[model samples]
Target chain A: MLPGGSTSVTTSMYSDGMSTSDRLIESTRELLWERGYVGTSPKAILERAGAGQGSMYHHFKGKPDLALAAIRRTAEELRASAEGALGGPGTPYERIEAYLRRERDVLRGCPIGRLTMDPDVVASDELRAPVDETIDWIRERIAGIVEEGKEQGQFAATLDGEEIAATVLATVQGGYVLARASGSPAAFDTGVRGLLSLLAPHSS
Target chain B: MLPGGSTSVTTSMYSDGMSTSDRLIESTRELLWERGYVGTSPKAILERAGAGQGSMYHHFKGKPDLALAAIRRTAEELRASAEGALGGPGTPYERIEAYLRRERDVLRGCPIGRLTMDPDVVASDELRAPVDETIDWIRERIAGIVEEGKEQGQFAATLDGEEIAATVLATVQGGYVLARASGSPAAFDTGVRGLLSLLAPHSS
Candidate 1:
């Protein structure tokens, strides 16, 4: 409804029957994923969403506000994706492996992980809380599973759940960095495989 | 020598009798580290370096050319730093631990790893080469030590050197992402500790 031109040309759902605010937030999410917070701009969001400047101001305070909405959405989505695997039926190791092997655009990198590289995201508490919460949520979830694994004797009883959880999280996030840096998914796969090898019992 | 401001006014090492090329490359490196390739601009580089706009174009073709020079320098510096620890005296695990525990600006993140998040850097082959090569070089270096550990009976002979090396690299790179996201170095230390635990033999 709020548009420079008709919504027919723009591929994004921004100009659809959706609320102007929702459209802006969705557009911001995509931009943030591709260009990050520092690289994304207000004009680009408007252009990509086919929404005009007035609509953006009317819906949200500014770029940062819209970005917050987008970032929160991304965090929720990430948690959902992770939960799908972590909460699925399996041993702790299997669940962890499933989460690690979840379909990912290796070259694109993690949306949350990529944000950490953005100075603006780290500089603002308002912007950083969702990221911090999401990471903590994941670490806690993985730690719970790891503890369960230890209790079941699936893992070494002496294993530290929180530390193992942190390592697992690190492997995935760092895999994206390595993959993107090399412009190949091989580096990511290698990292994951290496971690798995270390995780397995010596007999396995 | 080429500048629009008095040498004393500028804080960087621009007018310290350094060659224009060196000044340009150094300025580009610092800017790239802080702002990334897309966020950094030629004008900003010149201003920061206290070099004239004319000198930038005269010394290099454009941003990409200057960026390549800067990226190569960063790659070299990173290699040197890694060598200092990886090539130092110790058992393979000890050397690996030293490299992982080396002093770093945990909040600032890895200079090369940060570049992978930049769309401009990933999109260009030339810009990406140094990053790719640097990662490859480090992985290879780590793998060599791991191989030595296997031969020396410090590690399981069945271990894959390249794979373990990739995992170590991932832990460090991913640790930065977690630390930056949480605004604390605790996550980084946890990741390192977890990896170390996994590497040590259960009997030991």
Candidate 2:
């Protein structure tokens, strides 16, 4: 509704109840994931969104502006979904396990994590911020839970929360790489189970 | 040399001692790491290699052909470097620690692992074989070490060799993602150290 949708009545852009801007953002997100920033063209976004030629110009300043919006949207969604497990009802290890075991499109890879490999995204400060912040936020959030686990005597007293949190984050981001390389999620699954095994409390 | 570099001249391609084919392959490897398969153009490869228009044509069939050669080179280099540690003198855990602690260009990420994220590479079986094989070989190699440790009574017999191997691979791959996203190598180092801590042998 915010993207000046009122100007286009003769040639509608929206496919359904969603606004023109919303469709554009969604389309851009998908393209960014599949084709990356350099390969994702303005024409592709318009065609994918089913919007007319000038619809993109009306909705956003340009590709960068639109891409920024899409990236932020993706970042927010990832954080929220991760919180579903991290902030859920369970012990710290159990919550971490749940996050690891949560459903994912492993083959498609992490939409945000993959962006780091895109030189265009990594080179631009604006483009890189969301990816950096999201990964950092996840690490910090995980560290907090790990700290709670330590404080409650649920984990080894020597386990460094920040370090363990980084391991968890890397396991997930790297899991996608392994899974994608092999054309199977088995690597990702085994990695998670292995980390869980290592994190399991020792019996006295 | 295998690419018919002998035919090249004043329309010259070589900058120094290296043959035109070697330069082309080397250039393709760097570009693929920096720009990815889809973003890396033939023109870019030629320019970086300091070769003439017909240089790439003579050396390799085309972009895909050159890319395959480059990918194989990178894969082979990676395996050799990893083997330096995995096959080194140490206990099973010590050898693994050596591999994890090996110096790497963390911010640049793993050259072979990054290829998996390239849609073009993932889509092509010929282009993808080296990446898949390299990853599988490393995983299997690590699993063998884990199995070795279990056999020697150095590790708990219950540990799954394959699962732990996957965890090691994921940590390195995902560690790159974290390091690049944050614009520093600290995350990568922390993740490795964290894993080492977890893997430190228990004192009886």
What's model 1's lDDT at B11? 39
Q: Give the clashing pairs for model 2.
A: A174-B174, B9-B12
Predicted complex 1: CAPRI docking category: medium
Q: State every prediction's TM-score relative to the real structure.
A: 0.93, 0.92
After superposing candidate 1 on the true structure, give the runs of residues whose Cα lies further than 4 Å from its correct spot: A1-8, A11-15, B1-9, B12-15, B202-204
| Per-residue alpha-carbon lDDT of candidate 2 for residues B1-204, written as tens digits (9 for 90 to 100) | 113123233224455888889999987888888878988889877777778899898979999999999999999999999999999999999999999999898888999999998988998889989999999999999999999988988777778999999999999999999988999999999998888877777776
lDDT of 1 by residue, B94-118 (tens): 9999999999888788889899999
iRMSD per model?
0.7, 0.7
**Number of the top TM-score candidate:** 1
C-alpha root-mean-square deviation, each candidate: 4.1, 5.6
Worst 10 residues of 1 chain B by lDDT: B1-10
**Alpha-carbon lDDT, every model:** 0.87, 0.88
Clashing pairs in 1: none
lDDT of 1 by residue, A1-204 (tens): 124234356646544578777778887887888888989889888877778768888988889999999999999999999999999988888999999888888888898889998888888999999999999999999999999988888888778999999999999999998999888899999999999888875454
DockQ of 2: 0.76
Clashes of each: 0, 2
Backbone clash tally for model 1? Answer: 0
